[model samples]
Target: MSIFKPRRKMVVNREVQYDVLMYVGVFIVALFIVQVFTAYLFLDQVQRVVGTMSALEFIARYKISFLVYQIIPVSFSLIVGVYIFNRLTSRIAGPLFNMRRILQKARNGELETAEIKLRENDYFQEEINDINVILKRKSD
Candidate 1:
């Protein structure tokens, strides 16, 4: 059996934390985008009303265009952030959950319980291995 094992017990907690953080970050970014867009629209409307396409108007127009340019990147960031957070939490939580299930099975005198192998880069590899060691000892 490998030291790295998949986990499954902590699915709920990890997912909750990830969801909360992703929602909060997305909300803040969306709010900022709305505010900037609103300001640009307001200034553009004012300039239009005055019919003065002066330097200030030009600058506003350019900056508004720049903001538009940034929108795609910001949207990309939001999407990527949500995806990465979800993936990270799922990876971590999945292993714990699987390990928990194996432990429970072992407790019921399942000597041939499946081994809990963790990912090499997984954060909880050591813990899972230690637990496995303890189980092995108990089984013997």
Candidate 2:
């Protein structure tokens, strides 16, 4: 499908892309830490209530349930989150990259051809539209 067509370049703005990715990475790490801590606390409470099993023994016995209930969900969420963030940052960064190129062309007295036409899904459409109007008047 047209929507699935690959772009010529995935990382048009390296700085923005990497920065957003780093933030997402940090968020995922924080989430993982919280999940592990919460699971530990829950397991600790269960062991105390049972008064027979050690925490490690409980974990070892119910390892499959732990994996099914906690690890799997977190891993799946991380995958989905990364995919969504990548798409969102691309939409933002692609337009910014195009705007910079259009500005460079305008600086070189190429205003007539320096139209700011971004992808339909890209951010800054309204801003680019306003800029294109100004460029049109200047070229005229």
Which of the numbered candidates is closest to the native, going by highest TM-score?
2
lDDT of 2 by residue, 8-103 (tens): 767655755686778788777867886877588657756654568777887687777666667666776778777878888888889889889988
The number of clashing residue pairs in model 1 is 17
Residue 121 C-alpha lDDT in model 2 = 80
Flag regions of model 1 displaced more than 4 Å.
1-67, 111-114
Residues 1-140, model 1: lDDT tens digits? 98989876665445456666676787678758766776676566556545657778766667765566567656776786678667766767878887988988887877574567777555466677888888777766
Q: How close is candidate 1 to the true structure, as a TM-score?
A: 0.51
Please give the lDDT score at residue 76 for candidate 2. 69
Best by lDDT: 2
C-alpha RMSD values across all candidates: 11.9, 10.6
Least well predicted 10-residue stretch by lDDT in candidate 1: 10-19
Candidate 1 CA-lDDT value: 0.70
| Cα TM-score per model | 0.51, 0.57
Residue 1 Cα positional deviation in candidate 2, in Å, after optimal superposition: 60
